[model samples]
Target: HTSYVLGCAFSPNGRRIITADLDNKARVWGAETGECQLIIGEHTHDVKCCCFSHDSKYILTSSWDHTARIWKATDGTLMNTLRHEAGVDSCAFSSNDKLIVTACHDKIVRIWDTERGQLKHTLAGHQHSVRSSSFSADGNRVISASYDRTARIWDANTGDM
Candidate 1:
């Protein structure tokens, strides 16, 4: 990438790496050979974060283009796109890799069903842009930090504070 590399993560098994870039692309690389294996480039704006699922079979990415996407890790096939009302700042997969969480500039934290790519919950309460989010170890709760000067926790299944 000619521009900034915002984030990068190694796969759980340590054989591959994924990177998020300002060039509107996410790239998968072979860790051993250091070669670019695949370019997952569907986002129209800068990608802010990228991560591999706990089992290392899937990739999840967040973008300033107001979407989060999931892809097949082995071949870089696009699996799902989760749309948001504003730029997405971050995203993560649940412990079991069955759920996804995203933080957005719209002040909302969203929970998504990984299998159907459906919106499962909209965690609303932050007074400013949500900057980051992650699921609990059990995947039953979500924690988010916001520009609103607060960090909040919510029930991942219920979207409750």
Candidate 2:
């Protein structure tokens, strides 16, 4: 990365690492060798957050480009793009890896179907940018924290608080 790294995480298996940078790029690296394995430079703006799926088969990245993307961890194949009305601040996969949750600068939190790459629900209520979001351990709920000094929990499928 030619710019500052905004986020970095180790894969579940501990064999690989992923980093998001201000240069609009996310790279996967071999943990043991410290070698770059894959570079996903698809975002139009700075990449803000990056993480690997619990199974270590996928990578998720959030960006200021107004989108969050899912990728094949090993080969960097773009699997899906989760678009938002504003820059995405954070993203995470459900424990089962079947769903996704995204927090956006648009002041909304959204739930998405990971495999289909489609929107499942839009959680609206935050008065300020939603800074982060995550799925419950069982994947039945989503919790989002915002710049508004509030955090909300919603039913993952219904978008009901």
Best by lDDT: 1
In model 1, the clashing pairs are none
lDDT by residue (41-140, candidate 1, tens digit) is 9999999999999999899999999999999998889999999999999999999999999999999999999999999999999999999999999999
**Worst-scoring 10-residue span by lDDT in model 1:** 1-10
User: Model 2, poorest ten-residue lDDT window?
Assistant: 73-82
Clash totals for all candidate models: 0, 0
**Which regions of candidate 2 are displaced past 4 Å?**
none
Please list the residue runs of candidate 1 whose C-alpha ends up more than 4 Å from where it truly belongs after superposition: none
lDDT of each: 0.95, 0.93
Residue-level lDDT tens digits of model 2 in 94-138: 999999899999999999998899999999999999999999999
Q: lDDT value for candidate 2?
A: 0.93
On the 0 to 100 scale, the lDDT of residue 82 in model 1 is 97
